[model samples]
Target chain A: MAKGSLRINEISNAANVLLNVIFILLSFLCIYPILLVIGTSFAEETYLNVVGYKAFPKVISLDAYKYVLSNAKPITNAYIVTIITTLTGTVLSTLMIALYAYAIVQQGFKYRRFFTFFIFFTMLFNGGIVPWYIVCTQVLKIQNTLIALVWPYLINAWYVMVMKTFYNTTVPSAIIEAAKIDGASELKTFFRIVFPIAIPGLATIALFMTLRYWNDWYLPFMLTSDPKLSNIQMYLKRILNNLQELLNSSSAAMQAGSMLAVVPREGARMAICALAVGPIVLAYPFFQRFFVKGLTIGSVKG
Target chain B: MVKTVVKQLKDKAIEIKKKKSFFKDLHDNREYLLMIVPGVLQLILFNYLPLFGLILAFKTVDYSKGFFNMDWNGFKNFEFLFKNPDVFTVLRNTLGYNLIFIVTGAIVPVAVAVGLSLLKNKTGARAYQSFMFLPYFLSWIIVSYLVFGIFDYRLGIFNNIISGVFGREAVNWYQSPRYWPTILVLLHIWKTFGYNSIIYFAAIMGIDSELYEAASIDGAGVWKQVLVITIPSIKPVIVMLAILAVGKILNADFGMFYNVPMGSGALMPVTNVLDTFVYNALKINGDIAMATAAGFFQSVVGFVLVLVTNHIVNRIDSAQALF
Candidate 1:
């Protein structure tokens, strides 16, 4: 029996060691491609052709950076637009969603059941893109404007439900009662007391919002025709598509220009991805502790 | 008492009774009602309002006719869609890829999560979790570019390594249909496994530590404990997520397929799915109505699947039903 138990323990230990090694190797696989893009972006195009993408470049060059930066005006504009949209959109949406979530949590609200059903109903069905396009373009008249990107995605029902779940779970009844006894108005109670405690919950949603705004290319592609209003992702896509078109066009000078354009394409994509995700990634560690707490509180009940 | 005073008194009593009932209802269920409003409004504007536009699917659109003034085509648009020979191909590709994605996507993440949970050291586990999650943050476009770097026939790492070493011809991955399904599945797992694993990890963590202790006391090994305790504890969550995924098996990840394939016609046989098909058809024909019909079909099928799955779950275990 002792020998059998020892054998079982040995097998378990072996499996554990193997899993750790595999997991670490898998992690490297995920990170290396991203690093390759960065490395190639900084490497001379000639060197890249010679040595290919590597952890370290054969010959270091800033031609890609110089070309990208010289043509940086459009990218800069895109960054400004994306940042404004993400910040304003996240703040506005978060507030509106929290307000609505709070109202739904109040048992005394007159239309609670009706409203819940109304919200849940939308999850099941939606009118396709045509009506939405017509409504936004013809009725709202937001075509070729940044507002088109911001307005359509300003509120999401799923986020609201998640917020409501957090509120119901974490914000204790005693705290609200204490605030009420202290002569706090309903609005005051929400804005002052509830909002602070819900920051971690709000942060999770905000990270998602930032990601959505940063990654949004479809909206700008479909709605906006003007180049100036294009977000970074859209601009990058246009550049890539233009490169393909240029490759097919069979113009030597244009091909050279497209090759030159490829310089920024990888770095800029990495840069934009890095820039867009940098803050959230940086901020995530701070919220990591709270996230587990929030998830447990929010999900276990539901 | 005067007749006028008696009439005024009766009117005041009726008003008070009405107010009291309203107040009583409000007091009984105010919190539940408040919790639901924001979600309701968002749905109304973003979701329900778009739903009203489903009318466009039935119309033969003309720029001159305006949105509302377009001629009604009844089922003509849908008929056009069904008539196309490629429609069936696109549908089959979409469903086939998604079915593969669903099955593999469900399995791999759970495996990864279980593996991560078994790691003894906290720091190593955290580092692995974060690194694995890095791919999920990248946009599909960036991922496409990264894929090109690996599979770029002329200068790709694969070609450089294999052809250089073996003196063999380099495979043009973009042109090969047979290899794409595997490539796409691999990419999907790489990008998503970390994000999905978080849920399973949380579920595992929630399992009672005492259960493991009990198993250990019975001389059961780690693998046996996992089989007996951890799997059963988190079965509900796994089941819930699987059902949710089944609800949308008809909908493909459009961005991944569209961007990764990057308009390589040679690979369309493997890469083209329903969403991309609709996108391509609209691009070629500029037919808003037909595209909307496709969208409507997808939405309806997805909705019915969710309802049916929910019903099945309800029958088996009431607590697991999403609603």
Candidate 2:
């Protein structure tokens, strides 16, 4: 028996070592591409052309960063648009989802089934892309407007369902009952008691909405052709689609004649990407902890 | 005659009371009703309103004449969609890629989750998990840049490695359709497997520790423990997620198909799924009817798949079914 247990231990130890190596390699695969992009972003264009995209910079240069910042009009405009849209969309969507979710969960609320079904039906079927595009552009007439960015993602039914589940599990019923006994109104009870207790849930949904709004390029791509309304993602997409458009069309960048001649085309694109991806990567730890919790809550059998 | 009139009056009074209570229920929950109105309105505007516009699939739309003024045309757009040779390629690519994704997606995540669960060093496991999840946060546009950095013909790291490290001729990755299937699948797995693993990880975490303890006492090694306990314990979650993925088999991730390849015409033969096909038809070619027809086909088939899969799941395990 002692000999058999010793053999088991040896096998288990070997398995553990193997898993560690595999996981470490897997982790490297995940992060190496990101490092490559960052390294290329800082590399001198001439050296980059010669060396290709090294995991580390061959010769460090700030010309790409310099060009991007010096031609800051479009980038800044995109940042402002993205920031405003993300904030507005996150806040409004969270509140709307919370309110809608809270209402449906109320035991005494009439039309609860009707209201729940109204949103849930959307998950099962959609009008597809073309009709959605037509409705946004022609029917609502939100083309080239800020509303076009903020409105489409305003109430994701999946998020609403998640928020509803969060509320069901997180919020205690006794406090609401007591508040009702004291003659507090439904909205007042929710705003004061439920909302305070449900902060974590609200934060989770808000993070999701923030990410959704930040990463939205499809809306601008489909609904609006106007450059003035482009968010950061859409701006990046436009540059990605046609690199020459930004380099040549931005007259200011072109007027900086000597720099334009050395305009690290590949490096500049990577720099733009690095800049766009920087914040989210930095905040990923925070997002990951909450998102894991949110996903589990959402996945729970209701 | 008097008795009959009295019975009629009684029925009328009951009807009036029922009508009043219906309004009373509405009045009682007035605040709750008010709260959900905005969400309901949004649902109607974005979701349901577009359903009406689906008729455009069957119509010859003329914007100059306005939306409602379009003439009815039956089967023309769909015929055009089917008559095009590209439809078969798109359908095959979409279905084939999705089939590969569903299988690998389930297996890889489950393995990762199990591996993480088994690690004796808690901090190392956590760190590894975090690193894996990094790719999920990135927008596909950013990922495209990463792909470009690796695959860019002259200067990409892929060529650098092949020619410089391996002493082989560098291949133009974008221009080659044959290499794209593997490239795209690898990219899809890289971007998602980490995020997907989280769900399975959480499930594994929830499994009873006593099961492992008992199995170990029986002289079962790590592999046996996993096969006997871990896999069976998490089988429901694995099945549930797989079914959900199968339901979405017809709908490819648009961002992945569209942005990742950077619009390489050569790669389209392998990369052009239904979503991108519809997008190109609508945006690039300005063939609204063709795009709408394809979109309509996808939606109908997709809806049916969801319903059918949900039915199968319900039959096997109602708790796991997505109702």
Worst 10-residue lDDT window for candidate 2 chain B reads B205-214
The digit string of per-residue lDDT tens for model 1 on A1-302 reads 01112222323567768988999899999888777666666677666767666556778767655555544566678788877877888877777777777776765466756766666566555665556666677667889987887878877766667787888878886898889799876677888998899887887777667777877787887688898887777766665555542133234434444667444434443344444445555665565544445444444534
In model 1, the Cα lDDT at residue B161 comes to 83
lDDT of 1 at B33: 44
Model 2, B1-323: lDDT tens per residue? 99999999989999999999988888888999899998989999999999998899999978888888999899999999999999999999999999999999998989898888877667888889889988888888888989988898899888999999999999999999999999999999999999888888887777767667778889887778778888998888887788778777889999999999999998989999999999989889999989999999988888898889989889988877778
lDDT of 2 by residue, A38-100 (tens): 888899888888898877885998888887776888888989999999999999999999999
Scored against the true structure, residue A199 in model 2 reaches a CA lDDT of 95
Worst 10 residues of 2 chain A by lDDT: A1-10
The worst-scoring run of ten residues by lDDT in candidate 1 chain B lies at B31-40
DockQ, per-model, please? Answer: 0.36, 0.52
Q: Which stretches of candidate 2 lie over 4 Å from their true place?
A: A1-11, A255-261, B1-15, B64-69
Residue B148 displacement (Å), model 2: 0.3
Docking class of 2: medium
Score residue A120 of candidate 1 by CA lDDT.
58
